[model samples]
Target: MKLFQYDNFPQVTGSRVSLRQILETDIKDLIEISFYDAIRAETVQQAAEMQSKINQDYLDGNSIHWGIVDNANHNIVGTCGYYRGLDKGEGELGCVLLSQYYGQGYMTEGMSLAIDFGLHTLGLKRIWAATGQQNGPAIKLLERLNFVKTADLNDDEIEYELQK
Candidate 1:
């Protein structure tokens, strides 16, 4: 498929979370997430840079990112996406959830929707993710989703993949 062929960001709905395009209104929540020490101790400037990269990646067809919003409160809880890979047929899966939401299955549902969109809607043959070696929760989530470890990116990072 041609890059950037998608005219609109897809809104994927799961039971507990909805994946939609990140809006300007989500900046505050994003900043909050960025400031969390466990996530990334980002300054305002750093947070803005991260937001800009997300926008630019979407515009350039390099990735598609979505804000993970709760269905009940409609609050942005985190973000996830499919980052285009060097191979056109594949993309990298990425996500972040608020610390409070960890182990609650919210991210698992959100990521399942994103992976479905990548494989079914986007026609991607493979979707992959990389997590820190010590990120046990992330590794467990990926494993539960049937992603297989494929590489050791470094001492701190490991890569996993799921093929359609």
Candidate 2:
């Protein structure tokens, strides 16, 4: 299904954060976040490639990506979104947060917003995520959100899914 035919992308807000459209001006911040070990866009060229793909993916109707922004200072602390899956009724969820924001509940809040949009608006039957097995906090957050551990993608990654 085509999930991004909007003139204005929907913004999902919580008490501390908002998931909004990624803007061109966010390139620098996006680059900085890539430096985080978890994200790993090590060079400026790599960061640029990542940014380009994000923009192109939206345009190609492959995914809807949002910047997870702080409400108070309006800084982009991270990103979360859903990518269309090979199956018609499913989507894959993904997220990343700066280290400082790790335990602050921001990614959880942002994820809740994204999941709601995926299930309700996109009418997806299932939303899933795959994370490095060592990412304890991420696995915990997915479990807290009712995602069941379904399989191991590899020695390093585990997959989880939430069904509608």
In the predicted model 2, the residue pairs found to clash are none
Residues 47-155, candidate 2, lDDT per residue (tens digit)?
A: 7777677767777777778999999999898998876582476788988887777788889889998898888887888899998999889899999999999998867
Model 2 clashes, total count: 0
Put down candidate 1 lDDT per residue, 92-129, tens digits, no spaces: 88888887787778898899999888878877877899
* Cα error, candidate 2, residue 93 (Å): 0.4
Model 2, residue 52: C-alpha shift (Å): 1.9
Please identify model 2 stretches exceeding 4 Å from their true place.
1-3, 35-39
For residue 61, what is the lDDT in candidate 1? 74
Off by over 4 Å in 1: 32-41
